[model samples]
Target chain A: MKTKIFGAATLWLLACGPAAAESITWWVPNWDEEAARELVASYEEANPGYDVEIVITTWDTMAQRILTAMSGNNPPDLITELQSRIVLYASRDMLTDVTDWFDRDLAREDFIDSALATGTFDGRLYAVPFRHDGSGLIYNRDMFEDAGLDPEQPPRTWEEFVSFGEALTVEQNNVITQYGTAWPFGNLDNAVVRYLQLLYDGGGTFFNADRTGVELDSPAAIDAMQRLTDTILTNGIAPRSSLEIDNTGLRELFANERIAMFKGGPFDVDPLVDAGMNIGTATLPGTGGIGTTTVDGFSVLVPGRANNPEAAWQFAAFIAQPDSQTRLTATFPANRIAAENERFSAPLLQPFLAQLDEGVPKPSAEGWGEMQRILFDHMQSILLGSATVEDAMMSANEEINALF
Target chain B: MKRSTPRRGFLARLRTDKDGEWAPFVLPALFVSVLLTVYPVGSLVWTSLTNIGPDGVQFVGFANYVELFQMPRFARILGNTIVWTLLTTLGALILGCVAAVALEHRAVVLPGVWRAILLLPWIVPQVASATTWKWFYSSEFGMLNHMLMTVGIIDAPVAWLSSALVVLPAVALVQIWSTFPFVMLMVSAGLQSVDESVLEAARLSGAGPWQEFRDIVVPSLRGVLFIVSLVIVVWALNSFTIIWVITQGGPAGRSSIFSIYVYESFRNFDLHRSAAASVVLLVASLIFAIAYMARLRRQS
Candidate 1:
């Protein structure tokens, strides 16, 4: 009788013990970790059956870590990868198709078209866009005031942009104490993005209509390339040391008053303000025609190695919701409804939203990685005066075409 | 008794004689070597012959090698690698020997402090050194350019890292600074083995300082110099951190070496091409090793 009672008691104890909660690992870029953690905490609170682990990664190391993890058969359940890498990841089948999640669980029509298009590859959703950024001009109002240019009326045409820059530049005995603008000709990622914007602004595209071939050597594109490089070499408005700075480096120079202006987005404003600077925003100047800029962003994706796809998808869907995006610290939300929230309509972020209205997503073609690499080399050649615009364009087009 | 002979043969196979005793001692080392070096190298060889792409892995054989050879940048990359390795190795050795001899001289004071200060570059972390050097090499605001400008050396800032003709030497200067301490330490040790009396006799025989150094010191340090140079050549050839952190093999790849090409390939998910590049690099390193070992054998 006592043994029977004891067995019943043991069974009762076993039943009372806590069940193992399903856990999913998330790798996010360093910038969005705090927002991600808050969202994850809310997710765990709302869904008691799961736990989450967030690993912070940077852009420089994200690709490498993801590659290693995928190949090692130990990939995180979800990762936040940049938009440029989505096509590569999707083409390689490294990411899980989240089409059904988007279709069944969310209102797909509410997403910003460019943002959704960036995450879609070959008619399947491999990732969900979170925060999006596009290139625009951020100018120093104080420098504009000093140069006797109207601070309220930023340059809208390429000619005025160059003239304004030349006016704002400060030189002391041939050493530039304050550069008119810091164009990032050094780093490939920034340089290529700027180049793409210029190419698009000049009414040129990287590929033929069917996307079967590259057309980087087109006259319009070459003219665009020549004009951009000429701003540095021919006009002498840009610092020769411009090659020493990346996008962030340009922002730093602007913050420190070493540069008067540069290409950036709404996200750059707050940081520069926090760093104690007076900055203004404007649409990127156009080449006397319709303006265009390339959209760039980060996306949340579930790897094929996800241990808990259901739970991972749940997190992805939750994070893409308007509520979660509204809490993000920087970069405009990818959700149109969330981005339209009253707070984002502030004067500081409004220009970025306007710019995003006309922004085009990066090319989703398979050969984009190789194309970018070759373009970077050729762009540097032109910027450094080693190769002519015609020569660089021809060479880059030939190499990029060979890849296709 | 007849069956005992078979057992005795097995025991003799495991004998600890002069030749066979090393087997037991080296077994663990061999196991580690196979695990770390031999196994990875074998995997690299296998991977080089396979294309692990979007379609998954398949044997493609020499296709990757053919493509790599036909790559337009291959010749330039090879030339850059050779120039970088040779210049960095030679520059470090010359600078190190001079510093070592000067520090070892009797006229020098605070030798210990000087030695510690000289070794600071070697002791500091590579990432730190690279970051510091990046700041130092900055064109408009860098201390190097700033100092030169302050002294009225030039009216304009020199584009140390941007100009193609100047970038190779600029990067080599950083490599030399970071690496000379290794050569210094090695040469300092070699100097300890030099006979002071031999130097004294040379000096007493009406030999000036230059003659004493040429006649007595140079011959004594030849073997040390040779070994240091060979090691440094291999190290500089394989160097990635300094160049990667500083220039990222850019300003149009004027400073790119073989390792950067391999790394870029790997980063781009071109595993077959990366593996093929790795194999070629391994072969080049092996040739250096073979040449070094053959020279050492001849000297012995």
Candidate 2:
């Protein structure tokens, strides 16, 4: 009688154990930790017997950690990473091909084209983008009024951008107490992105038509380089401190009223508002009108070697939904329907959204990391007056092409 | 009263045999070293001979090394590494020796307190101090520039980290600051061992402070100086935290060294190139490490 009872219990456990509890690990950056935990809790509540584990990563260590993880046999079932990094992993065949799942569950037309493009490499989607944004003109409204310029009208052309910068600049005792604008020329990544914003705005492409090599020495690129360097070197409208700061430092300068304007993203709005500063936002000015901004964002990817691909996909698909995206995104959601939610309708964010209309995805070529470093070095040469814009761009073009 | 003899165990034999005893005791450490150090290093060397990428790993012989050498910036990066290592090592040695000697002077008051105060830079965490130094070196809002300008030393702010011309030295200064205290402590210990009779004889011979320091103090601390210099040279060659935190080898690779390049290559997923660079750095560091080991063995 005892043996029969024990056998009956063992049989029941064997039949129902896995069905009763299934767990999947999700690696997310610290910035998304709280939101991801809340989402995981909600997901667990809605679906019985499903568990999503959250592993917090950090900006400084995430790239190296992810590379190490993906190269190994074991990896988290899901990862929330930068969209720009998707191609690098997908090219390695380290990510699951989510194209079919995306098609079956999410509406293709509802997502932004550029955001989707970041996850698409070699004509297959490997990730589901949740958040997307591009840089816009984030300015101080009171500084604008103080400069005697119309606070309502931001620069719509590159020429006006320079002129307005000059007008807003404050000089006292020849020390230049305050500057008109500044650039994030210190950090290699931020410097490259800022330069790319100008390069794209002026109708220059980073790669040739076939995407085989760089076209940094093109007329459009040289023009962009000259205009960007001229802000500090020739025009003297910006402070020399531009070379010592990144985007975050630029925001602090703007907050302290040290500079009048800078190129920033929608995420800067809340912090600036919270600091009690009256700010204005506008699309980046181009040679003609609204310029192109480099679109980058976060996406959820399933590692190719994930233990639970099916369950990870279900959670990923659920997160891609409009409501989930709205809750997850710190910036604008990749889903157009979710972007239309009342939370994103604020005036400060509208310009960033408008900028997104002309946004181009950042280059995701295999050697882009090394290529960007080359470009950043040459750009620095121009800013430091060690090399001319033409010479520096020509060198950058050659060096980058040599990599290919 | 003949009793049955108890059998001796292997451990008992090992403990009894003095010469062979250490082998058993050292075997675990030897095994750990082989597992941790030799295996990883051998793997790195093998990886350096292959191309690792998204496609797959392909054995490419010396292609990675050839490619690294052929790169346009290789020479500049190598030159930067040598200069940075030398600058930081020499700067730390001189500054530390001087500080140690100063604290040892008879006129000095509360030498311990002064030594402790001077040693603060070394005691502070590299990340924290380097970050603070980065802000302090800022051209616009930095206290260094502000103080210089306020003192009428210069009419304008100096771009300590922005200009390629000044960036390497700027970062090297921070390296020197963080490491000199170690040199000071070593020299201070060495200073205590200098024979007092020789110094008294020199003073009785009417030797001035400069002569005494140059002849007696300098000669007495040669071994300490030699060992300290080798240790610091090794540290400088392997230096990453200060440079990485302060400049990230930037403003156009003006301050990039071997370690920075290795890290950058690794971050870019060019693992093969990173491995090759690591081997190069390992070979370079091995030269000093071998000398250090030889000196230690000779002393022992």
What C-alpha lDDT do the candidate models reach, one value each?
A: 0.82, 0.89
lDDT of 2: 0.89
TM-score of 1: 0.90
Writing each residue's lDDT as its tens digit, candidate 2 over B28-125 gives: 99999999999999999999999965467889999999999998889989989989989999999999999998898789999999999999999999
Best by DockQ: 2
Candidate 2 lDDT by residue in tens digits, A91-203: 87899999987775566778899999999999999999999999999889898899998879999988899999999998877678778899988888898998888898888
- Kindly list the per-residue Cα lDDT of model 1 for residues A1-404, writing each as its tens digit: 23433343344324322353668999988888887888888767755667899899997788888877876677899888887678777777778899986676666666778888888888999888878879778888988999898989998888888899889878887777877787777776788888888888888988898888888889888988888888788887887766666776677778878877788977788888887788888888888833578997888888877778866876777777777778763678888777878868878677778888779998766646567779988988887788998999999999888887
Task: Determine which window of 10 residues in candidate 2 chain A has minimal summed lDDT.
Answer: A1-10
Residue-level error in angstroms, candidate 2, position A151:
2.3
Give each prediction's root-mean-square deviation over alpha carbons: 7.9, 7.0
Clashing pairs in 2: none
* Per-candidate chain B TM: 0.88, 0.91
Error of 1 at A1 (Å): 65
